[model samples]
Target: MGSAREALLDAAYEAIVSGDWAGARMADLAARAGVSRQTLYNEFGNRDQLAAALALREAERFRALTGQAAREAEGDAGAATAAAVTAALTAALDNPLIKATLTDDTSGLLPYLTTRSAAIMDVFREDSVAIFVERWPDLALRPDVTAEVGWICETAFRLVISHLIVATEPVETTSRHIAEVVRRLMRDLTTT
Candidate 1:
């Protein structure tokens, strides 16, 4: 079932990247995945559901990459934050789905990354807070500080998303600026 689901998602991804999502029939996708149409509907329920699932899967991929970047710079909070932002922005720049959505989203898929992005935002915020708490466990000792950490995480994540949508500067400059802002914010939060 898992393999079938993955294959279906892979097929969906290809269709979306090719600007054929609006015309991609479930039967076609099912055939592309070498599965029956019933199996596709059983796995994802409907076309909209399948689109949401694909968006969610991509969000998880971004979360994983960002988390790994943070972990790699475990000892330095600023460096970790910077690395995470860099990874996200870099990935977004290279991601075909993102490019497709940003350029010409005929599949009505922009909502998954914009107005309807609460779930995606939650994924990034939760993972980022976990990373912060891991690095500075002292944050766990204070409930208020922990909440602030979540806010900081959301802010940083939103900044990266903004850069992904409309780039006014290079990834390096934006990432460094966000990192500096996070460092200042953290200093204020931790000192008091």
Candidate 2:
């Protein structure tokens, strides 16, 4: 990427992580990255596009991390999947950029997710399914395993929302629920 592009992303990311999303206004971003607002727009299109891009970038980073963990987990799909869910939840809660995006009322990520824009959240679903399928394959899954996987991902994402956006519970407490989802799913697959 060009320096300007890198700078914009970096500045946007920093502003989010530092609780300065507002300070990251377009003019502020342009100034911080040594570009004009027009240049920033030219590079990233607009603020909404910038937000989406940054959010996707963070998602990519998360997927890469989970993918590595999933590979390390092969042959032990259940154990690996459980661990991956735990790791993903923990990392997402602790991730400044993620927290900023999900919890930041001003930015509108939560509404977008809660609404119909699966386009944004689908990355998580696709990445999760891909990682699980890569390690376990359809043959390994019980007849009901696919449904279980879907439920697990949906519930886990909701927990993240509840914990971060609504402040309904502590993160550590919420992440443990992931274990239950995994347990039931994996047990079904492994048993009959």
Candidate 3:
């Protein structure tokens, strides 16, 4: 099994995914984790910290999957970008906690993704930029190219996140469209 902290995090995830983020009391989460409320507080400090930890954990999970997609596509940045976007979009759609966090107004989880995104985005951008660097090592289309691949990766990531939150179109369609855009950009850069 997992450690006590891991178990607590798992229980918190379950509670949040079950549509009880607002109603899931700390004592209740503690009970579900088979820990005392004092233990929960000692482990997570407070509700905001617990939520932050949860969000970071989820983000890390998505990043790892996306990184795997990029790695599998190997030497093919376009395909890798597409694969990563599709993977993230697909996973997000299947995750109830993510759906509720994005669409549910009462969960109070949206701010962690929106208003408090800078810290998360910084970490995400660093890791994602590394993925792009690994995918396209000689992308020196211009003298001032300056991490163009990173820009594309971050932009695609933002588009996917926006699509997840606003849902302007079907996830499949949006992912395909993102892939096409990334492919076209990569093509243009390689040609010049």
Residue 101 lDDT in candidate 1: 82
Residue ranges of candidate 3 with Cα displaced over 4 Å: 139-148, 183-192
**Evaluation by lDDT, superior candidate among 1 and 3:** 1
Q: Model 1 — TM-score against the truth? A: 0.93
Give candidate 2 regions above 4 Å deviation: 1-3, 74-78, 99-104, 107-117, 139-152, 166-173, 186-192
- Name the regions of candidate 1 deviating beyond 4 angstroms: 74-76
TM-score of 2: 0.71
Task: List clashing residue pairs in candidate 3.
Answer: none
lDDT for predicted candidate 3 compared with the true structure: 0.75
Candidate structures ordered by TM-score, highest first: 1, 3, 2
Local distance difference test values of all predictions, in order: 0.88, 0.66, 0.75
Candidate achieving the largest lDDT: 1
Query: Please, what are the lDDT tens digits per residue for candidate 3 over residues 24-96?
Result: 8999988998988998899899888888888888888988888788778754566777778788888988988
TM-score of each: 0.93, 0.71, 0.82
- Superposed on all Cα atoms, model 1 deviates from the true structure by an RMSD in Å of 1.5
